[model samples]
Target: MLGDIWNATLKGMNDLAGSVGEGAREKSLALIEDWLEIFPQLAEYGLEITSFSMGLAISPSLNVELLGKHEDWSDEAIAKRLADHKGEHSITTVLSTIRTAYRLQKKTQAPLRDPLILKIVVRISPEVRVVLGQPILDD
Candidate 1:
């Protein structure tokens, strides 16, 4: 069940990218790669990115879903862990990195703009049976 949901979500993201022009698609894929570069840091907080999607519109945004390494870890636990290390939650850390990257990209003649919306979801377990009507991380 979980796999189906994830697969569908990924497919939707792919479709969105395909619908956009080639330039936007390449930029979005590149942004995803840049975001992946932070895997090590995320691992430190017992978090691993499960899936992600980038949306380019009036305001560019990146939506990320993360799963905890341990089944017992809750969203608060992850947030606390990150706060202890970086004085902020996981979302803040990720957003800061993303915004910085966007700024650098813009400086290099990229079409990305500032104030990018970043949405992060931290799931305690991968055994979720439903994608809807369930409590999300940080809820």
Candidate 2:
């Protein structure tokens, strides 16, 4: 089940890269690689990326939603711990790299562009279940 989910996620990411255009495909793939590298670190904090969306407009941006589960901890506590740990780990650096890659892509792409934005939203949940055959949860 886990392997299937992983494979689907990779396919989705590859589709996103292809949709972004040839010029930016390499950068998009790199960003995906960077994200994969940080997954284990995030798991240590009981956090997992639930979903992500990318938009191109005046500002090319990627929005990532993370769901965290810490049964004994309050949402605020989880958020605080993740924030502190993020600074101590490669999260901040990787985010910066992603933003830089988007910015570079923006400069080379056609049409007008603004600064790239990487928005991350973290939410605390008591439990997270990966429903079989579902790529993403509705709730």
Error of 2 at 69 (Å): 3.1
Alpha-carbon TM-score of each model against the true structure? 0.32, 0.31
Residue range 69-127, candidate 2, lDDT tens digits: 32423445445655665754346553344434435545777443332222352221111
Model 2: per-residue Cα lDDT at residue 49: 64
How many steric overlaps does candidate 2 have? 0
lDDT of 1 by residue, 52-81 (tens): 765665234466765542332344554555
The TM-score, computed over Cα atoms with residue i paired to residue i, of candidate 2 is 0.31
- In model 1, the runs with Cα more than 4 Å from the true position are 1-39, 70-139
Single out the weakest 10-residue window by summed lDDT for candidate 2: 123-132
For this target, which candidate reaches the highest lDDT against the unseen true structure? 1
State each candidate's clash count: 0, 0
